[model samples]
Target chain A: MKIHEYQGKQLFRAAGVAVPQGIVAKTPEEAARAFETLGGPIAVVKSQIHAGGRGKGSFKEQPDQRGVVLVRSAEEARQNADRMLGNTLVTIQTGEEGKQVNTLFVEQGLKIVRELYLGIVVDREVGGPVLIMSSEGGMEIEEVAAHSPEKILSEPFDAVAGLYPYQARKLAYALGLDATAVRSAEKFLPQICRFFVNYDCSMVEINPLIITEDGQMLALDAKVTFDDNALFRHKDVVALRDLAEEDPSEVRAADTGLSYVKLNGNIGCLVNGAGLAMSTMDLIKLHGGEPANFLDVGGGANEDQVTEAFRIILADKNVKAVLVNIFGGIMRCDIIVSALLNAYEKVGFNVPLVVRLEGTNVDKAREMLLASGRAIIAASDLTDAAQKVVKALGA
Target chain B: MSILVSKATRVITQGITGNSGLFHSQQCRAYAAECQPGVDVFVGGVTPGKGGTTVDGFPVFNSVIEARKKTGANTSMIFVPPPFCADAILEAADAGMELIVAITEGIPVMDMLRVRRGMEKSSARLIGPNCPGVITPGVAKIGIMPGYIHKPGTIGIISKSGTLTYEAAWQLGRVGLGQSTAVGIGGDPINGTSYIELLKMFQDDPGTEGILVIGEIGGSAEQAAAEYIKSHVTKPVAGFIAGQTAPPGKRMGHAGAIISGGAGTATEKMAALRAAGVVVSDSPGGMGDAMKQAMQR
Candidate 1:
């Protein structure tokens, strides 16, 4: 689950992280009020979406403007906010839908002394949460990683032992911080770790954690992603989940308790297991067709789950065809076939469905499906099924 | 013969008195009895509250120690609920059970972390806290896997993935290369047993002649195991890492299956395994042929 930049910053601020004073505005009137309230000579108007790279885009800053006159004179900022508010702003960092700008964050702009990247993630190899610090920060962190990987210093913390005092100071040292800044950063690490564990975050990144001319470290931008599975434990964090930012198909699939991820393709896939579903998608790609979505009905998929799965798949507008691949070990094929037929009846799918069912009463499943004669195509092997789906899609 | 479990290995089912626990335990006992005549592989069980009760003629005990003492059951399979799974595994581990298979899924990551922390100090080995469990062909079935498909043979199987194990085993069975012992270590982000641990065990077993490993995206467990196999294991090994083309930054089946910023990909894992002199399968179906070719080599 992802939250907007302003939300992340708000959470960070609540945790005592230094952030520029800001207000989330939904309209030009609210934006004007935010500009006036900040009372700074300059203010940055940023589109508050769950995306980065907004600064490079049309989002602008009005410098040295004062009061209601500044609000009136800040035409470009108002126009940019107006243009982005209801529309999807496509930034380089944003994937697919870019990000829907429902609100804009108006903040006091600062004169930065230095920009740095700071992030914390669960390191797979280290088996603990690790804080990554880089002197070179902001949008080019990816470039820095690709070009000069050694610049990023990783400090792993044992959650049980907590973040060590020495490790925090070391991370601060790695970031080339001054003594005061080191002390402040040292104080910040425990709070960040606390926030990470308390919020069940998968990642918390602050790009361009800038040092102002006044020598205070201010987080200019924040990106946070919470663990979806852990959402059941954190209702407050779950409430922060922005449904508007997610794909409709995903939202609908979540409601049905099915794991669905939309992809750019024509063949809609529904498989029992996640690995099989992924393999089926790979096979579809290998056979010269794109998989429209990754839909796993999970281990126990009854008739209703199957119906809901179909409903979610059919909801994808890009889906030109459908593929139902079941490698039933514990799951019965005859039961899946019945569910497929029932789902087809309820949803009245217009696209072609190419199903490959195996294991546990497969013959009975084939018989039931063949008897239906509902224009559903059946193939024996995964390759053949993928080929058939691709051929049907004319890919 | 199998490595961990065989006809002579006494079994105890932890959480045996619960509905699913009793039902699956009964199924396992019935299957084991049907597999061979006078096969006393399954001996007794444990359920905290229902200690004195008899579950299908097998005496249940209050604790793992009591169960082990009474029945001399060295192997224990857990069917405890998600909340109690970690405790059950810990209890079994603390009891010094030779092998423990936890079929319970959704165990909290924190609990498992602590469980793993304890497991590191213990002598006992754990298979999963969120897996289908393991099956040693014709000897003992300690999982939810349908016992009919398996036949005793030389193909030693290890997998971070569960469903792919079933698919690979089914294909191998079709090609007349049934498993010696197939273990689904599971795809949980924080699991107990790893590919390296299982691979080492499989390498040592005399009954196992060849090995097949089914891996997925996420951790470098497959790569680590491949490196180990290349260095130490003399037997032929085949590998298949799933999610070769999984989209970037998407969580697949397991929490561990996330590919962030293009790291720990299937391609990377496959490349690593291939570079390590392990025969890597192009698809799930190719696993059997890959093993055959590896054996030939």
Candidate 2:
């Protein structure tokens, strides 16, 4: 999962990486207090959201207001925070809908001589982690790679062996760092790499890594995402999750062991697997309907989980119809049918519902649904199910 | 001839006493009993400490070595949990099993990385730690796929998703096209096999005339396979990628389903496949029709 820039910097500090002093503020008063505590000539109030490109992002409610504002005094910091908090921010990374800003990072401003970029990510093709550095730092790395490919350099290393000294020195010289900064990097880069390995991180990006006039190097901005599958090993990292930054339905689905992503559509889709859930969404779109949400009840879901999934799907007011598609293998079709029936009885389906069951006692499932005499549309197959759902919606 | 398994393939179950292991093992045995003309493919099982006992009439051994020794099994399917899955794969690899299919999900990436490093000197081919295993219709069923939906035909299928494999194979069956062999290579960042490997296998199989490749967002595997098909593969192929409407930078319930650093988009994959002369369908429900049209051409 993703954490805010302030949290990432905190972890960076704990890892022996240099970062500007910062304090997290949840309200305008707190931001003012943080600004006073920093005692700076200039401070930055950055809106804390999961997405990147926050500096270029603008508040939707106050179109002229930027998400990140630099102010000279505590009153200005408070004003900026008041303008940003509880406002929706639209960024290039955050789709058109954007995300809400609930917290701010008030950090002391820094003096920089030059900017560089450093990142550590798993190179899937290389089957290990790689360190990517570039002379072009403040700009988007992908854009830099596209336009000026010669500026980017990468070193792939074995995680088990740790980052080698020679690898770090080579990258430091490749980025054309001066003698003092190069010496600093020899000590700094490996620590950052160690942080990546120590935290079970999937990605660590330090954009616009700055070198001060005094030859000190520091990370100006950090974005870290940990491996979700490895979270069981690190409870401290799991505690960093922010529920306010996520969609409520998605958070609830995770708690209930269902996978759900809400979309802006009218057709509610329920499928047994991830790929099938996505394929079902595509089928819904193919039949001239938009999917309201993508819901995978998992392979071993029971009646209670199914009922909760139905409740979560119906929580969206935009849902016009429901489509239940199950290709049960380890999960029996009769059990799915029973769960569907139980969910309908509990939730009281008002919209048109289409059900398609296949594999493992499917005849019994179909017979049970037929005997129920409910106003549910039983489809013959996947395509038929899509067509039936689309037709029922009068789309 | 099938690509991976046939009537002569011998199988053993690891984690045989577990719920999923016993259920799928029994289902596979029942399918073989009803469909196979004369071959008994499932040989024995392996479970730690539960060895010397019998599960569903199959002898349970303490280790893969003992199971192989007792049954002469050359292939094994794993249903172990995530924590011990890598160890299980290493055990099978060291025991010299020819093909190992791991059906367990959520194996840590670091574990798999170590396993891949360990397999450098070993010759065993691993299919998945989070996949539905291989199946050759009417001959041998190795993993969790329902056998009733498949039939023997000229099509070879390889997929990254378990249920989508069944969906695509069922679509092919509905169109009167039977499958020669179907394999789910699993949905992880690093897997044992790639689409290029399986495509080469299908290209060489005399009984297979067409291929159905089900790809998704997340890696360069599809683009790599497209490049391979452009130069090497001669069989007619159809492609379907899930998550066409998926948003950028979101993991759609699959560990390997994210579009990272502006790559691995469905649109890009589809274009690559089409450039390689593979008929690619936009909607998965229409994939069988797309393959049928490609075959007719």
Highest-scoring model, lDDT: 2
Q: In candidate 2, which residue pairs clash?
A: none
Candidate 1 error regions (>4 Å): A58-80, B8-23, B36-72, B79-84
Across A306-380, the per-residue lDDT of candidate 1 in tens digits comes to 998988888778889999988877677898898889989999999888999888899999999999989999999
Instruction: Give lDDT tens digits, candidate 2, residues A235-285.
Output: 888888998888999999999999899999999998988888988998888
Instruction: Provide the RMSD of all predictions against the true structure, rounded to 1 decimal.
Output: 3.6, 2.3
Q: State the DockQ of every prediction.
A: 0.50, 0.62
lDDT of 1 by residue, B123-180 (tens): 8878876677788877768877767667789998887666667777877877789889
Please list the C-alpha lDDT of all candidates, in the order they appear: 0.79, 0.89
What is the CA-based DockQ of model 1?
0.50
lDDT of 2: 0.89
Candidate 2 chain A minimal-lDDT segment of 10 residues: A156-165
